[model samples]
Target: MRSRLLFYWISSLLVSGCTRSGSPPALSFSGGLVVAQIVTDSLQLVDPTRQRRIPLVRYFPQPGRGSAHKLKVALLNHAYHGKNTDYKFLADNLVAHGYYVISIQHELPGDEPIAMTENLYQARYPNWERGVQTIRFVLQELAQRQPQLDWQHVLLMGHSNGGDMVMLLAQEHPELRQVQQLISFDNRRVPFPRRPYPRVLSLRSIDQFADAGVLPTPAEQTQFGIELVQLPTTIHNDMWDGATEAQKQQMNAAVSHFIEKK
Candidate 1:
């Protein structure tokens, strides 16, 4: 059966939008600065077997300078209690730079609050486990809907609780190897997945410390080829839209560089 799509799509503005400004400069890509057209679509993927609905806010790259070629895919996960709409600033940035970005909503009303215990890694296992399942369902459905996209370079990015989902998804499903990279913004729980494939780049905040063992050691980082950069001015809460223009610019530069270097 075809997955039901609740389409509420809109063709917003053609950009030069890097920030929420009246008139920002043209955005830069790995190739260089270029004009790009982006569209936003709101939809949900129903998991009939699991009896769950995964809401999604898709930022699609239209035919323009950056998107004329095969567009790379980015799946964004929201933080605990955050709506899929929270990442528009980041999503728009990626879309301008030639990525087909889909921000996923993982939390549903009446769901149990995530644990804040000392042993968060194990205590919150169910939440993280369920997260990957929803993601898997979304990807399967998305492949059907957006078959022309470049899935092989699909990169997963999230902030705080959402960031934790990045590593867990790659860890649990090794065979889901199309994800070329993992970019997490201050995931506080669950140790970094120790694998060579699917490159890892974690942007850490200066104000918050991850749980013990959540971050890899210097040796482990080198062994695993992990790139961990600390953002001196950003805080845990500001990883989303709360970030200042300076903070967003720095974070954006780092993130853009990471995805483009390959």
Candidate 2:
């Protein structure tokens, strides 16, 4: 009889602990996790410079991090055949770390598709140039809309073909002087320009190889402080939404840490 009473009392304690003051347990996201706003605008912006209507996916912290002051900006470009939202994982991480992320859809409906070329660097010139113009216009558009954002410090990230565009833009017109960090995910063709202001990072996939000179030499990397991380078991295609939980965690953590540096 005594034993039964003790067992029942323990069970009751467990039930009460699981329920909070007779209320159902609250749904919890991990502590210090910033919930970001997704698809706030859902609009296709017209870029007169490119004469193309560009679609973009924007993410920002719900209440916004450092809204009183100017928050940083992140411009994410997508891989070839990939949509603007494919890199949500990285965009969300950026927002959590106090950045306003804008993922650009470089390829639009009825646009000329990127294709294989005899010489990738020379052939993709127009595509990359068009992308640069799109980025320039987007920055101008955002300035008009959200002038409070910190235009001095920006982060540029992209995957595959989009990564190529990121590199090209960083090296070309306007010189992206505001860019504090430049990251490319498995961009195989474009040569990473040697620069000092915007620290460079190249996340290489295990399955694909960058064309010769696309990557920096070890000595040059040391000089410029370029960070190159090779993902284990992660292929080029998996850099997007197709990534496994482990891959996503690894990539997200790496990016978060890099951007976290002051």
Candidate 3:
């Protein structure tokens, strides 16, 4: 009986140690690329059907360039193919403006280039829950990897379907109290839990999803503590690209101001 008890104690210790050591260290970026130093391991979620793994890239700001303090931001790509182009541009700009940008390649539809709105809404190929889980997984992974990152300073920015994703994530994962601010571009539909966090920014264009209608009615907006910004001449695609230098400056200013206020 004594020996059995000793063995059980040892086993418990081993289990606890493994649990503490299992998590991977946070990824870091140094030079121009600001590439992630550690490769992300597959993250498992509650819904098995939604389990799909994708790579997340990190773009760290050049040290001592813009802001002395490091700000970690997560940029979620629109549903479509999860290509890194749009995010790459955004990350580069953010990095230039003094931010550590981590952009994720969300699960695409059947490994092909397709619109995420149609696929996610239609339930044609890729599952929407999978994308949702991916965002949660990445956020947790970053928290583990970068202890230096200010949890309260973290921001979530998305475009199109990606915009919708930011709202969904903020609503679902209240436990991730670190995410302080959220910004979405050209997103039409606003889900329940209308108010998420203290600061929310939505930028809509005249074309594409905006053509459908403005979501989160003024009453909902008042309840949610959201700030809505509408650009007159911009379109859905313009939200991603095709913005002139003046427009880009305006966007940069808006985002920078939001971060500063938060």
RMSD of each: 9.1, 12.8, 17.3
Cα lDDT tens digits for candidate 2, 85-160: 7876676566656677888988877877665858767888888888878888888888888887888888889898
lDDT by residue (tens digit), candidate 3, 89-201: 45545554446567666654575443445424454323344556777777666667777766556678888767666766777777767777788876555352465573777
lDDT of predicted model 1 = 0.76
* Tens-digit per-residue lDDT, 1-262, candidate 1: 0111112122232334433225445565665535444567789888999888888888864444453467778999988888898877778778766688999999998789889867788888889888888888888888888888887878899888888887788888889989888889889886778888788888887687887777777777779888787777778888887777667776776776677775
lDDT of 3: 0.54
Candidate 1: which stretches are off by over 4 Å?
A: 1-28, 31-34, 63-67
* Per-candidate clash tally: 0, 0, 1
For all predicted structures, in order, the TM-scores are: 0.86, 0.83, 0.67
| Global lDDT of each candidate | 0.76, 0.71, 0.54
Return the top candidate by lDDT: 1
Candidate 2 weakest ten by summed lDDT: 1-10
